[model samples]
Target: MPPAPLLLLVFNRPSLTDRLFEAIQEHTERPIYIAADGPRADRPADIEACQGVRDLVLNRVAGRDVRLRFQPSNMGLANHIPSAISWAMEHEDRLIILEDDCVPLPGFIPFADELLERYQGHPSVAQISGSNYQNGISRTPCSYYFSGIPAIWGWATWKRAWKLYDRTMPGWDALRNTPWLSSLFHDPTHAHYWRTLFDDAAHPAKGSLESWAIPWTFNLWTHHQLAVTPDSNLITNTAQSAGTNSSGTSHRNMSPATGIEFPLRHPETVSRNEEADAYAMESFYLGSHPVERFFWRLRLPLRLAPLRRILRLARRHLTHPQPGA
Candidate 1:
C-alpha cells in the first residue's frame, strides 16, 4: 500500500471543514485521513461546526484514498487534536496536519510533499509549516528560518520529531529550573503568553488550550529543532475569536494571505524573519487586543529571578483572565 501522506483532524466545525475539503479537493491525489473528536460535555458553541467535518469524512469525493477515525463522544479540543494527530502520525513516517479553521490553497499539497521528502530525517528540521507572517518573505523564496510558532494550517511533520511529542505535561518544574532555556520563552516583545497559557493549563478549574501549545513549544525549544516555511502562505486560520478567552467577538484583517500564490521549490536556507516572528508572537500569545508581545533578546542567559516572576504572573492571569469580551 502507498504511504499515508496526510491526516485531517476535525472537530465540530463543519463549515470550516467544508472549506478545508474544498481546498483539498482542488488537488486530491494524496492519501487522506480524518480524525473526528467525540462530542464534549461543556461546549458553548453550536456543534454545527462539527457536522461539516462528519460530512467531509463520509462523503469523500475525488481523493486517491481516504480513511476515517471517528470518536464516539466529545473529547474536547486539546485531547481531540493532539490525540488524533499522534494516532495518525503513529501509522505514517510523516504526515500533514490540517485543522478545520484553516483553508489551504492549491499549492499546499505540493508544498507539503516536497518538504516531507526534503527533511525526511534532518534532525534540525522539526516541522514544515505552510504560512508566513512576513509580508515580504516571498521575495527571498525557497525556505525561510524557523518560526517559534507552529502553524496547523496546511503543515507537515516527520515522525522522528513526533517521538518527542509529550501529551502529558512532562518536566514542568524541571522546565522552570533550566534558566538558560528561559531564552526560548516567546520573547517578551513577542508576548509572554505561552507562560500564561501553561499556567492556565495547570489550573484545576481551567480548560485545556494553554496546555497543548506551551508544551509543544517547550519540546521544540529544548531539542533545538528548526521549523521552516514556504514563501506563500498555504493555510488560512479562521479561528481568531478576537477577545481574550474568546467571547463571541469578530474583527477584520483576519485573513492575511487569502489567495496568495504558493509554488513548489528546491532546497535552500531561510533566516529568521524576526520582524514577522515578533508580530505572530504578539497576536498568538497576547491576543489581538492591541497588546504587543514582549521580547528580551538581551537577557541572554535568562536570569531565573525575573523569568520566574513573569511566568508566575502569566499563569495567574491565564487562569483568571481580566474581564473582557
Candidate 2:
C-alpha cells in the first residue's frame, strides 16, 4: 500500500523546511499536507521568513497531491501543532508527521507505513516514532521496541490515538498525587521528573514553554498506551540549537540519521521496554547520572553550595549507603 499521508509542520524556517520537503519528495509519493504557523507579531523578521517557506513549498510541490494550511495569526507550538494535526486527521485516518527540522532517513516513510498498518487498532500502540534516542544501544533484537515515552521528532499516529490528546490535561489533577505515574517506571526518579513536567504542563504559569507533546504523552500514559520506536535512529533534528525555544546545542542533534533494514523483525508480544525507557529517562531527559539526579532533588541552595563539593558528597553517599543511619 502507498505510505500514509504525510504532514509537514513549518514556521519561520524556509531552509530547514525545504531540506525536509526534499527528503519527503524523494522518499514517498503519498499525499502531503503542509501546515505553517503564522509569524509572531513581536518578531518582524518572521513575516517574510514564513512567507518565504510557504512560497518555497508551493513552488516545489507543483502539481502533486498537496494541501496547505497557512495560519493568519500565531497560535504558538502548543496550539498550532495539535490543531494542524487535528485538521489533517479530519481527512485521513492515519498520518505521518514531521517538523521542519526533522529530516527523515531513506526507509522512514515505508517503516512508518508498515507499522501503521501492522499496529492498526492495536490498543497498546498509540504511536510509531522514527527517532530513537538510545545513543546507539539496541534495546531489543527486534526491528523496534515499545516505549511508554513517545518521541515526536518524526512520528506517525492514527486518529483514534490523536483523539486522546487534551491540551489542558484535565485528568492530571486526579493522578498527580497518586502512585499511578510511579508504577509506569522502574525508577522513582523517572516518575518524579515526569510528574513535575506534567504538573507544569497541566497548570502553566504565564510565559512558560508551551509544549503539546508533553500533554499528548501524558494522555497516552493515562490510558496505558505505548509508542513503537525503531531500533535505528531514522530522523535527525537539524535545528536544535538555532530554534526559537532551544537553549543550546545538544549531543542528540549531533547523532546521524540512519535507515532501518527491510523485512522488519516483529516482536512476539507487545510490551514496553523498561530498560530502554530508564536509559532514556536518565541520559536523554534528565541528562545526568543516577547519583547526580539524587542530589538534584535535595533542593540545595545553589548559591551557597559549591558544585565540586556537592558532586563529591553525592558520589560518597550514593556509592555507599549507611544501614539505618
Candidate 3:
C-alpha cells in the first residue's frame, strides 16, 4: 500500500518552507497536501509573509494528486494547524505531519512507513513521532520508548486517534486545579509551566498548542499506549530558535539523529522505564528553570565534555564511532 500523504502546515517562513518542500520532493510516490495559512491584513509583514508562502508553493513541483488548501483569513496556530490536520485526515486514513521548521532526515519517510504498518491495528499505539528526546538512558533499545510529551513536531497520526484531540478543552481546566492530574503527568515543574501556558491562553489573545496536546497526552496515558520510533531522532526541530516565538532562547547545533533503524515486530510487553521517563521530564523542566541555568553554568565544563562533542558529531556520521574524551 502507498504511504499516507504528508500533511504540511505552512506560514511566514519561506526559507524554511522552501527547504521542507525540497525534502518532500526527495521522497518517492508520496502524496502531498499543503495547508497554507491565510494572510493577516492588519499586520502588513504578516500579510507579506503569508503571500510569500503562496508564491513558494505555486513554483514547486505539481502533481495531479498534489493538493492545496488556501484560507482567505488568518486562523492563527490553534485553527490553522489543527484544521489543516483535519483536512488531511478527511482525504486520507493516516497522515505524517510537518510544520515549516521541521526538517526530515531522508530515512524518516521509510521509518514512518514501517511503524505505521506495524501498529495500524495496535489499540495501545497512540501516535508515531520522528523526534525523540536525546536523553542517554538505557543503551538497550527496545524500538521507541514511551513519553508523556505528545510532541506535534514531525509527528504522524491516524484519523481515529486524532478524533480524540480536544483543542477547546473543558475537562483539562478543572483538572489543572487538581494534583491528581498534575502528578499523573509527572514533574510538577513542567506541569506548572503548562498550567501557566494554558492560563495565558484562557483569555486567548493567540494560539497555544502546548496546552492543546495535553489532552492527547492524557488520553494516551489513560489507555496505556506507546509511540513507536527508532533509537535516534528522525526529525530536527529547527523552529526552537529561529522563528516568531523563540520562547526565550534557541537551541543551536540541532542535528537530526542518524541511523533510522526499523524493528521487525512490535514489542508485546510494555515496560515503563520510570527512571528514564522521569529523567527525560526532569531534564527539560530544570533546563528551562532559572536556578538550573546557573547550575548548568557551574557544570558547563562537564556538560561540554570532549565525549559529548564527539558523540554529537558521530551521531550524524554513521561511519565513525564517537571519539573518546
Top-lDDT structure, candidate number: 2
Full candidate order by TM-score, most accurate first: 2, 3, 1
What clash count does candidate 2 reach?
0
lDDT of 2 by residue, 1-325 (tens): 5579999999988889888977887754688888999988888888898899889988988888889999997888888999999999999999999999889987898899999999989999999999887888888889999999999999999999999998889888998888898788747767766776676678766434478988999999888899999998999887553545322111233236667899999999999999988878766666445656555456343421243355556666666867875
Error of 3 at 190 (Å): 3.9
Which residue segments of model 1 deviate by more than 4 Å?
1-4, 42-52, 61-64, 135-143, 185-191, 202-211, 241-255, 258-275, 291-325
The residue-by-residue lDDT of candidate 3 on 258-318, one tens digit each, is 6465544345665554555555555553343444433333333231223234333444454
* CA lDDT, candidate 2, residue 264: 96
TM-score pick, better of 2 and 3:
2
Shift of residue 259 alpha carbon in model 3, Å: 3.6
TM-score of 3: 0.76
Worst 10 residues of 1 by lDDT: 243-252
User: How far off is model 2, as Cα RMSD?
Assistant: 6.9
Per-prediction TM-score to the true structure, in the order listed:
0.74, 0.87, 0.76
Which parts of model 2 are misplaced by more than 4 Å? Answer: 245-254, 288-325
Q: Which 10 consecutive positions of candidate 2 have the poorest summed lDDT?
A: 245-254
lDDT of 1: 0.59
* Alpha-carbon RMSD, each predicted model: 6.5, 6.9, 9.1
C-alpha lDDT of residue 227 in model 3 = 68
How high is the CA lDDT of each candidate model? Answer: 0.59, 0.81, 0.63
